[model samples]
Target: MSFIHLDRPDCPEAHRPEAHHPDRKLTARKLITRTGSSPPVHCGHVAMVTRVTKNMSAKAKQSNKSADKNANDRNDVASKESDAEKANPQWKLISHEQINTLLDLTVEQVQFQFEEILGLKNYQTCLKEASLLDYFVSGFWWTREMNYTCQQISFIMALLQFLLDNISEKQMPFVDNLNEFAKMISGTRQSPSPEVDSLFDAEQAMSITDYLKCSLFQNYQLYEFLFSQPREELLLGKKVRLPASLCPYVC
Candidate 1:
């Protein structure tokens, strides 16, 4: 029977260490690799394999911990930014009806006092576009009779949206915000400091805006005069009678 050759091919005979001391009766069959060396030096020393493996494992764990720390830091920054935003918001969570109940008759509403008008733009989705257009055309302005096209309605609607959204306790956006509104409608600019996104990004807003720019934004002033409704003014008349002098005060 032929004997099986078990010597490693990489450990050549010339590189094999000769056994000089009798303490190590090493031969080619007894090959041991030296620690911390490449090319697998054939020697008679035990390699410190366990120590090297432990060091590499420790380095890997440290890298993992550093990555986790960086992730936590990013998450903390995001959370703080969100909290800051929550602490200071530009617009409050209030409805149009609630605002209407608190407002006084505005100068814009004065025109309505002299006409049988019904051209108020409602923010609620309950009113169909057809009905809204009908109100605009028939609200004593005779928009259809004056040859006002569909684009005119679009311009009127954009103005109403800007007015309603930017309205404050004792302020409205008329001539003061006219330029800003025009820029917004033409898709050229956004609100200066709004909490919301560009208005044209909303449903039907972009189409209407395009039509407004293409057709009827030129007659913005005339349309404002014809179909504008006055807001109700809030007035309180209180009469107080003082004692001992029969004096009365009205405020």
Candidate 2:
């Protein structure tokens, strides 16, 4: 029989003995109601909380990313500034140590390039010509970077003159040919004059020469000391003064 038919008072009820339990029926209804209500309300609250947390987390991540990008941009700017400073060297403002280091490195590179070009036939013939130009150009650039210091311009001129003279007056025949090498090939092969070619005024040349002399003296004190000493002491004319302590090891 169908459940509706059996539940009719007129028909014999199926499981009539169990139908009288009121507490169980009430408990079962309460459990069904709670189970249905719990899932939707609890699930909705949980979903809302999860979405809020996700939004906050995503916002924090975006903020961190932006901060990282800004930091990278700042670093890039700082690096560029440093590179510019290096490329445009401030010769006048640089410290002595920095100048010395720069000079050593540049001279080494120049020497290497000169040696490499020395073997080439045309370079061997005209190497001095190119080198003469190189020296003047390097000085020009140095002066340009130094805010066109008249003193520096003069120093370079005097220094070049001294180098030319010393190289021409050196020992050996090959060194003597350097004088010919310094000749102006472009303008009728005349002997090169550091003073004449230089743009510095006469007064400026004097100042530059004085400064260059001082600098050379400071750098080559040992050379000066050695060269100035007399080979023949003339022991008979001047008696040597004995040291306070009679040790032969006395300096």
Candidate 3:
């Protein structure tokens, strides 16, 4: 790098002897007599010029190598950051339709089930349950006239579960409108406040919902494990496990 800097100011036309004619003549005159008809080349001066050329070439090569290395390092850092962003992102709510493919339960229908069949007290408790799978299993039938696919039923259960965990203060009555519920799940409507927003980050939300959606479409045994036994029996496990699921809501 310094050689290039020096060449810009000191050796503008390095290879051309004519470009440095003034210096060449001074060197030649010093080595050869002023009156000499035939002047021999100054061997010592020639050797010095050759050495300077070689040194400049080497310096240029080293500078280029360092520049290439820096470029590669920058590219590697950019690639790693992109991968990290994909792995974990910010979370947003989604629509119920995105998650459910079965019977379209109106918000009125869901509310009716909550108020009439399950009643207000149990409805509130059910919404606050540890596992939505358990709450749905214990509550009123979602299907009566229309044949409800198990997949649709499971999505409804999972949606309810998400609401229980993330329902904002303003959206408490949002279940009254199916359209609103759809918007809530898809993250279209701005949540009333930060408090009601999804608790999980983008990556975690994606993982949990992906599993719940898969279980909705397929037959799964883990539903029982997720929320099956009676509350008393479920709480009978070891002390370490007892505080894992319901403790957040209870405490």
Candidate 4:
């Protein structure tokens, strides 16, 4: 007798369920059936998993965009700061005490020349007629104009000598500060030439006066501040006598 064996390896092929196709889409029903779980529970879990995956991808993209924006903002801020720093350079200013000290030193240095001018034969007449104060403030004598006498020229040259002797890199911390202060006071558009060592050399004859003229003509702001603008303390109690007209401005 030929009896059919359902549990044997030789069981009929038509009786076994078909194998799942590799390319077939996996659905909630298929998953639940494969796992031997309830359809409702597995379908809900699958939907939640899909939603969670989409949310995570969106969050990652949002985080990346936020990071990019933050980086750009920082770069922008840094660039602006750099531009601001470049636009406005840092400058140091001389103190009031330093100015006072410089004035005193200058007067002390030029005392001999001042006396020499006063000793001139026509000193009184020149002081009355010529703008002696203006000449001193200008620190230069235009021989062509012949407005100032030899005495006035000598005095201005002496003051220029004092300035050349005193204002040195060794004497002052920042020489450019003094130069910049001069520029601000003069309201001049041109800047002075860079301070030169040869101009300050003691061996150079009349180089000090030349340097002073160059500086003043290039930027008269400093000259105005030092001499034209009156300061009570500048020559107070000093034997230096200014013209009656200038006494109000200087005394």
Error of 4 at 188 (Å): 16
- Candidate 3, run of 10 with poorest lDDT: 85-94
Q: Estimate each model's TM-score.
A: 0.24, 0.28, 0.26, 0.27
Off by over 4 Å in 1: 1-26, 29-47, 90-251
lDDT of 4 by residue, 1-251 (tens): 88876556666743554332456655777778888884465778889999999999999999999999999999977875564333222211223333233343444343334334434344344432123334442343232133433322333344444443333222432355456434322321222223312112232224433545566445444433344333323432457767899888883
Which regions of candidate 4 fall more than 4 Å away from where they truly are? 1-41, 92-251
lDDT scores for all predictions?
Answer: 0.42, 0.46, 0.44, 0.44
lDDT of 1 by residue, 149-227 (tens): 3433333433544443443322444555556555545541242234534323344455544544433355444344333
Winner by lDDT: 2
Off by over 4 Å in 3: 1-41, 90-251
The order by descending lDDT is 2, 3, 4, 1
Mind giving the per-residue lDDT tens digits that candidate 2 earns over 1-251? Answer: 64567566676654665455545544455556857642234778889999999999999999999999999999977875564333222333334443343443455464444344333234334534444445544554454454544434443544454544453344223333334323311121121233324334456445444543443334343333333445522122566788777767775
Q: List pairs with backbone clashes in candidate 3.
A: 93-186, 93-187, 94-185, 94-186, 94-187, 95-185, 95-186
lDDT of 3: 0.44
Q: How much does each candidate deviate from the true structure in C-alpha RMSD? A: 18.0, 19.5, 20.6, 18.4
Pairing residues by index, what is the TM-score of model 1? 0.24
* Global fold similarity of model 3 (TM-score): 0.26
**Model 2 lDDT, full chain set:** 0.46
Pitting candidate 2 against candidate 4, the one with the higher lDDT is: 2
